[model samples]
Target: MTSRPGGRSARVREAVLDAVYAELIHRGYLGMTVENVADRAGVHKTTVYRRWGTVDVLIADALDHTRETDWPVPDTGTIEGDLTAIATEIADTFTDPERRQVPAAIVAAALQSTRALQAKQAFYTARHTEAAKVVTRAVERGELPPQTDPLELVRLTCAPLYYRIFVSGEPVDRTTAERAVQSALAAARTGLL
Candidate 1:
């Protein structure tokens, strides 16, 4: 639809994305269908077929869009603060009822499908790209070693939170998030990164 201003196409796209997200959250990736999404979005099935053509592409598009809107990296002054903010954001993502299930489903879908996996990787790559700035800021401030790998550090910082959700299935809270921040900070301070 090109995202042009004041267009019904944009509205329809938004509705389709909204329907896609709701379906992913409530029914999961496998349960998601173009017919169901079209019905949910109040559009014709042919419209969905003509626009996206498949559930895989629609799920990937919806996921990529969510990553653009959500998962913003915080620019708190210190590395610890930044890491803490990142961890908190991750925790909130897992715990927030409005968001929790869909991501879990997306992650699972990523494990099952190449298309979903590429979309997940792209979303994480973009998130880490923004988050890398925090590590760069820390290095610039002399808080980190000059050779620190920003994206690697960002991955380490997020891994625990993802583990909690995708592996342990444990509840993530502020305290859990803080522990992850502290652990990463400790390792970082020791030049382990």
Candidate 2:
């Protein structure tokens, strides 16, 4: 089907993203090409080139799409509950083989590409913003103390999960997620966060 103007652009973008992600998973970043993505998405090479201009732009766009669809921070009324929910969501993402590989690949790419670094920053910024909203709400509701630092709380809540996923290359199971949540809560309660 031919793409329209407004909504069709988004559809084309999604198709390109899906194609790029598939190529990334199957062949890694070094092997990914606009021509291959266009072929996979059933579009011409010119279409991909015209839209994204470069491979880095396409990769960045794909990463942004992946994060938007997959990462969702939860709000559960209380700080502890909200954090547990967020931890569970994070654990689930890290444990998913496909999802985990995407971030791993992106990190490798980010090391060499400034565009990749910007994309990673944007993804984390979105997550941090969502988390900040949750923490801010908790403070307003008296679930957390007024002096609580939202950014620090977010770091405390997510650091362990990232550590396990990236450093140890371990699966983030429910038990581990719960432990992280508990540890963060303990520190938060003690006014350390």
Candidate 3:
């Protein structure tokens, strides 16, 4: 039989994952150590090693946990409002110095580790799938055409903000979020998506 959700095994996993996130934010990927994470989690180093085996796996497991957590999908009664809310949230996350380190570290780790790379891809896929609900809702409400691809529209809505944060080194604000939403809406209306 499977273990209960709140059993000792689950608690250990939760503590270790939380420690991994804290360690990653504090020391980044290169400086993060399994011993340090185990210490922070109040577990022995060998326990961490026996389970995760490496720093990359710890980070991957943390990401997997995050992906499984429920994200609040926006429902503002309009496609524009929902899309804007989604884009704004992305801007808010990357704009925060402490929160920004997690994704930055993930990208850095994915470059060197295949496990991290797959985890990163799966994380984004889950997020995009969840956010695509807004587009799907818009179609049901007759705001967007039936042919519009919900996932593609969701990706278009997020792409520009990510481009600014990860590519162009540009400042992202409420106005940037609005622009991204409008651009994606325009694309959807024109059947480009």
Could you say which candidate leads in lDDT? 3
* Model 2, span 37-138: residue lDDT tens: 999998888989998877677888887887687555676778888888888877887687666556777877788778888999988888887788888988
| Backbone-clash count (model 3) | 0
Leading candidate by TM-score: 3
The whole-model lDDT of each prediction reads 0.83, 0.81, 0.91
lDDT tens per residue, model 3, 33-139: 99999999999899999999988888888999999999999999999999999999988878887777788788877887899999999999999999999889999
Worst 10 residues of 1 by lDDT: 1-10
After TM-score superposition, the amount by which residue 33's alpha carbon in candidate 1 deviates from its true location, in angstroms, is 3.3
For candidate 1, the lDDT comes to: 0.83
What TM-score number comes out for model 1? 0.86
Candidate 2 residue spans exceeding 4 A from truth: 1-11, 25-31, 50-55, 65-72
Q: Give the least accurate 10-residue stretch of model 3, judged by summed lDDT.
A: 1-10
Better of 1 and 3 by lDDT: 3
Steric clash count of candidate 2: 0
In angstroms, how far off is 4's CA in candidate 3? Answer: 6.5
